[model samples]
Target: MDCDVLIVGGGVAGLSLAWRLSPSRSVVLVEAEGSLAYHTSSRSARQMQPSYGPAAIQELTRRSIAMVEGISERLPAPIMVPRAMLTLGTETEVAALVAANANLESLTHSETMERSPDLRPETFEASALDGTAMEVDVPALLEFYRRQAIGTGAMVLTGAPVTAVEVVASEPAGGTDAEGAGAEDLPTRFHVTAGRHSITAGTVVDAAGAWADVVAAQFGARPRGLQPHRRSVAIVSTEHPVDPSGPMVEPADESFYYRPDGTHLLISPCESVPAEPGDAQVVDEDIAELIHRIGEVTTVGITGVERSWTGLRTQPADGLPVVGFDADVPNLFWLAGQGGYGIQTSAALATLAAGLLTGTLPDDDGWLAGALSPQRAGLG
Candidate 1:
């Protein structure tokens, strides 16, 4: 089969971009897993906090807020629920927290206690709340993207593991008089093979999460030194009753974090250690550390263990998403290295990436283009 674009990976990044590009281009998306979002996309924190992440990610997420808020019109179900976020800091970290984000409203200890009585008042010397934060309906959002892409004539292949990507300088069989190029002289095209299916496309987008560099290498593109960090989360029952509606809580330094998950609490050690990309598993040491850290910030006691899991957060060397075309490989676009902010920034990033791919991006978007460029990280 032939398409104008072939997207590698069926995570939120690839699905959303296919949704955005399908109306104007013949698109085909392939996922290695049996279903969409079997990895990081499904294992996200599911919070829409534009304030979290790097400068470019912050800009993308901030812009995505509008799209997320208005997404109900496009999807069959709502994708967000109102939830507040509190970033707690010690006395020494107050100034740094405020400097890092001017939007963080300084809250008194009394106010913090009133907002979340479960937190140990003495352990937190400063508190700030971002009222705009919300719990994202990640599954619903992924479903919407998948459905829309298919509905718009894009082929989405799940359980289709891409085994090879052949990139070679080849001309279109027909001469392109507009480019003054003969049938023998044109740029390259990508021949992608997934399972028993083969697709030829003028462009290919890498959105393979932790396996992004692997995908690039398969296609003869330079690997960007992409690193996958293991993040573990645990769910445990608390001895003390917690308000189900309370704001999500975390230390300003992010040593550890816990949020009410129905009657229980979901906690994370805030760990991001480098790991090989694959199905991630929770380690006993990480869970033990999480329980110990929770005791430091909260008065609640863990009564019983419930469950735990781990996921990979892929970050490029420079720690920003690598978007835009490969500077060295013609027709090779990149949409990887989103780290933990992939879901929150998907709407805006997909729009930006689709626009860049089609050459319709506004000139003023050059700042964003430069920031997310593959060359910026020397991945070219």
Candidate 2:
């Protein structure tokens, strides 16, 4: 099999790029697993807290909001549902809450709620509502991308784990006189062997999420600071009656967070650890810590946990995703290390990745040098 672009990993990053690129080029995507997003993408808390992170992240997420909301006539289903988020902190943290409110006011005109009678203000020195935050149906999103890619002549092959990459060292057997080769006209090629097939592509995009580093290593590329960490979540069936539509709550100190999920509550301890990519299990200690946070955050009934699981949150040393062409490796592109914001940041990053691959990337996104450049992180 062969294509103009071959994308590895079927998470939001890969599928989003595939959907974008396949419309203009012959693209093929491969996923190691039989199904798409069976890991982190699926395990994400799926909340779009717009003003909850760094300034760069806020910019990237704001850029993605238009896409996740699904451009008119683009998706069959609505991928984004507006839901408010609140940050509650102790009296000592009131100043930070005020600062957050100021930032959000400048960035967007979304609603703001300073106090919620439903919450205890005595324990919380400050609290603010994020009107711009939204909830995303990640599964629906994955399917949406899949449909877009397949509908537009792109091929998606599942259970296709890339084992080895064959970089065309010399001029490809059928070296082409591609335009703008200048004095260097070496035909660039990547032969990736995955499952029972050897697929060649003019360009290879590594969107393999937590395993992106491993994929890079296969191409003789040393990973710079790719670090995959463990994040655990649980849904507890509290007997106490709580507002099903209540605001998603985050600790003022950025500790644990909980959101109203239907009749139950989805909670996270916000814990992270250096680990590899895989379907992680909920550790007992992590579970205990979460329970503690739950008690501290709300007066809801202390009920049993309905379900629990863990996922990988990959981040570079500087804590941002890599989303540009490789500095040294010919014909290879990168779109990985999205941390927990991959879902929220996918569309923007996908657009940027596509732009880079097509050689049509804009000049002044400031993204080329910071988070996107593999060389900037010493990964090249």
Candidate 3:
């Protein structure tokens, strides 16, 4: 098959980009798994914390939240629901958080207990509340992107693991053939073999979550030293009745986090252990540690784990996403190394990527463009 763009991952990043680009370009998205978003995207904590991540990521997340809210009325269900994030910590930690986020409300011990009575009073000296946080309906958002992309003419293929990528032709410096052919007659740049399908396209995007670097190497592009870290989460039933309206609880130190999930609680150790690219497994020890930590800080006893899972959050050396075209490989673009911020920043990243691909990005956004550039200094 021939296309203008070939996206080599069907996670939120690839799907969102396909949705944005399919209106003006012939796009083909291929996923190795039998289903889209079968990895990190599906295993997310499903919360959009605007204050989270680095400055660049926070800006992208804010942009993405607005975009999602704009489309909420059209979706089958609301994509975001108000869920304040209550961060518990010592007085020093709370002070630091207050200094960093202007919107965060510093909470005294009494105020913290008023918001979440389950928290142990003596464990934390103070806390902060970010009322802007929201619980994201990840499935709804993913389906919206997938349906929009397919509806607009993008072909999405599942179980199509790419086996080989060959550079069919070198792009000229001026971005056309030496003969100066018309746009419709431009030379193909990549020939890709994935499972039972063969594809040729003018551009290739590497959005493979944990295997992003592996995919880049397959295309003869330099690996960006992306590291995949395993984060484990578990759902456990509480001994007491969980308050559905209670805020999501997390420590300022980020050792762990927990939020109400129906009658149970969704909890994570917030661990970032380096891992290889593959399906991650939950470590019993990690869950044990998480339970112990919760016991020290909360009165809501976890009776037993109802379910547990793990996912890989990929990150570059500097812990920022890699966007824009590859500096060394012509016609190759990167949309990887989003780490844990992928879902929250998908829309903005997709918009930025589409602009970069089509050369229509506003000139005023140069700072952002430079920040996310694949060749930016300190990033592999």
Q: Could you tell me the TM-score of candidate 1?
A: 0.94
Task: Provide the global lDDT of candidate 3 against the true structure.
Answer: 0.91
lDDT order of candidates, top first = 3, 1, 2
Candidate closest to the true structure, highest TM-score: 3
Write one digit per residue (lDDT tens) for candidate 3, span 10-53.
Answer: 99999999999999999999999999999999999988888888
Candidates 1 and 3 compared by TM-score, better number? 3
lDDT of 1 by residue, 255-302 (tens): 777888888988888799999989999888988977987887788898
Give the per-residue lDDT digits (tens) of candidate 2, residues 1-380. Answer: 87889999988899999988987899989999998887788888987666856666777788888777655246666767777777765544645565765433211112222333344444555556678888887887778888989999999888999998887644544554555443245656788898887998888888998899889888877785788899988888776766677778777667788877887888888889888688777787888878876776567765888888899999887777787778778777888988988988777778887877887778877654365677773542
Clashing pairs in 1: none
Cα lDDT for residue 322, candidate 1:
93
How many residue pairs in model 3 have overlapping backbones?
Answer: 0
Each model's lDDT comes to 0.86, 0.77, 0.91
**How does candidate 2 score on lDDT?**
0.77
Q: Estimate each model's TM-score.
A: 0.94, 0.89, 0.95
